[model samples]
Target: MKVEWKGVMPAVTTKFNEDDTLDLIMFAKNIRAQIDAGVHGIVLGGSLGEASTLLAEEKNVLIRETVQLSEGKIPVVMTIAEQATKVAIAAASDAHENGADALMILPPMRYKSTDIETVQYFKDIASSTDLPIMIYNNPVDYKIEVTVDMFEELLELDNITAVKESTRDIINIGRLRNRFGERLSILTGVDPLALESLFMGADGWVAGLVCAFPEETVAIYELAKAGRPKEATEIYRWFLPLLELDISPQLVQNIKLAEVATGIGTETVRKPRLNLSGDERKRVLKVIEEGLKTRPILPDYKSF
Candidate 1:
């Protein structure tokens, strides 16, 4: 299936059993819910999916399971968040082998690479796989910014086809559009900035909160893309508090907690990462509960 690299592609959280094993059953249920909610694609093993902590074998399971569950209903894209060029390339190959339709790759983690090194890292990975790539550009979190000029250098790679624009600098969206035009599909990576980015011509949203509130997320994207910004804004306003949770440092825990509240998945995370607790737990749950209590009626989004 050819992914258009457009619409609400949730950076889905990886569901795990209490023993820290991959819960394929609950994971499939989450993917099915997102598909039923009309998401354009599903991205696995991203930051939201806790890629940093997962073993390579675990990631393969996620990629394969997502592909099997999606069953061609939507594209299943796995993330490559490795710190080394060789590991990233190997991951791309493995994802392709496991039937991932595409990949969302971040710049090298841990050691910050210079502009040239960053470009080369992406080049090496792109050369290793035929699957389409979405350049995950969350400089705020990842600490390596893929500047517009750097992107100009990367334009030579054909498979490096899309950008997950999470710079938080809204101006960069226009800069990317003005520079790349249609050469790169620009998908907004920041949940709070989804409306603004789409309004400013972002091609789609690689959303975080969509994991829990899939329908609202897709509705916002559809409404905005269909030129119904007024209607979209109404929902965005109602959804902002829940959306803000995606930007937090504890986004994975927060989103998974929301998932538990919504009956889509569990809140169990791997070690070094604990479930939300005490005041933070109550605070986050209150926000999700309030939103659930007043969950806005979403418009019927027409799927492609």
Candidate 2:
């Protein structure tokens, strides 16, 4: 399945049992929901999927399961975030062998590498795999920014074809479009900026909140891209609060809780991480509940 690299591709969360084990049944249900809702693709083991806590074998399960469930309906792109180049290469290799169609990768985790090292890191990984890559650039959270100049250097690699642009600077989206033109498929990584980015000519959205509100997320992207700005704005305004959750530190818990509220999945998170609680729990729930209470009737759009 060759990824079109346009439209809504969810950075989906990994569902777990109460024992903190991978719940393949429940996980499959979630993936099915996204595809059924008309998402263009699905991304696994991303930041929202708790890649840091996931074991090596666990990621393989996600990649293989997503591949089987999707059954070529949508491309299943696995994310690779590791500290060492060799480990990232091995992980990328494992994803490819297990049938991932593409990869959404971050710079070397923990230690912030220089621009030269960053470029080399991507080059080495791309050299190892035939799968196309979407460079995950979230400098605000990840600390290392893949500047346009670095991207200029990276353009030497043909397979480094897309970008998960999360710079949080909307101007940079335009910058990328103006700089690279069709050479790069820019997918907005920040949920709150989805509408703005799409309007700014981003090719697609790699979304987080879509885990809980798949249809609404897809609606916003389609409506905007279809040039129905008014209809898209109506939905985007209603979705802004819930979308804000994706940018928070407790994003995993927040999104999972929203999933539970939406009857899609559980709020159970792997340890070192816990479910939302106290005032924060109430606060998040209030936003989700309010949105549900007045859930807008989405305008009709063609299905993928």
- TM-scores for all candidates? 0.98, 0.98
What is the C-alpha local distance difference test score of candidate 2?
A: 0.91
Clashing pairs in 1: none
Question: Candidate 1 — what's its lDDT?
Answer: 0.90
Stretch of 10 with least lDDT, candidate 1: 295-304
Q: Rate the local accuracy (lDDT) of all candidates.
A: 0.90, 0.91
TM-score of 1: 0.98
Across 1-304, the per-residue lDDT of candidate 1 in tens digits comes to: 7879999999899888988899988999989999998999999887645788899899998888888888888899988888789988898899999999999999998999999999999999998888899998988887999999999988899888899999999999899989989998999998888999999999999988899999999999899988888999999999999999999889999999899888998999987888888999999999999999999887666752
Q: Which segments of model 1 are wrong by more than 4 Å?
A: none
For residues 206-236, write the lDDT of model 2, one tens digit per residue. Answer: 9998999999999998898888999999999
Which residue ranges in model 2 land beyond 4 Å of their true spot?
none
